[model samples]
Target: MSESKRMDPFTGEKVEVDGVYENEAGQEEELHRGDAFPADLILGNTEWKLTEMSFDNHHEGRTDERLVPKEKDIDKQGKIDSPRRQMDRGKK
Candidate 1:
């Protein structure tokens, strides 16, 4: 007989279901967005186990902005040494 493979819940792709992995705290470790299919079977007390695998195009839903939450806003005012900050004391 042949065994059927299950799909990954997050990616909706066919994946091979394996045994559960644990962590130091005995809690289940979460899979990140960029995590690859057929995750590594990590052993610890947190119960982190590689559940399944995913397709190549799994991160279609994630937005570019989401990947980089915030960026340094450019200063449009220019440098402080510019004429803007200089006081016109001579005119007074």
Candidate 2:
């Protein structure tokens, strides 16, 4: 048996592992866009070392202008915004 480790749902591009405990078995998964990645590793009890690791780019992040509502579109609570179109003056 070993101590439990906590990890963030999202992973960064870089990772630094400290040490592994004995009989440590776990699985780490990173989801991005429409892609799915699964990773499995067995941690050693000796020293802090990265045994089995992998990186996957799911590319699930995005910004859709259509999803954004206008100022008036939303109520006072700010839940939604109005869809009024605001025209910008032509400038050189």
Which one is best on TM-score? 2
- The residue-by-residue lDDT of candidate 2 on 1-92, one tens digit each, is 34367433222223343222112244323333333222334332212223444333324545455566555664444334444444456984
True-vs-predicted CA distance for residue 30, candidate 2, Å? 5.0
The C-alpha local distance difference test score for the whole of candidate 1 amounts to 0.40
Q: What do the candidate models score in CA lDDT, each in turn?
A: 0.40, 0.35
For model 1, the stretches where C-alpha displacement exceeds 4 angstroms are 1-30, 33-45, 57-92
Off by over 4 Å in 2: 1-24, 30-60, 72-92
TM-score for all models, in order of appearance: 0.17, 0.19
Cα error, residue 25 of model 1, in Å, equals: 10
Error of 2 at 58 (Å): 9.5
User: How far does residue 3 in candidate 1 sit from its true spot (Å)?
Assistant: 22
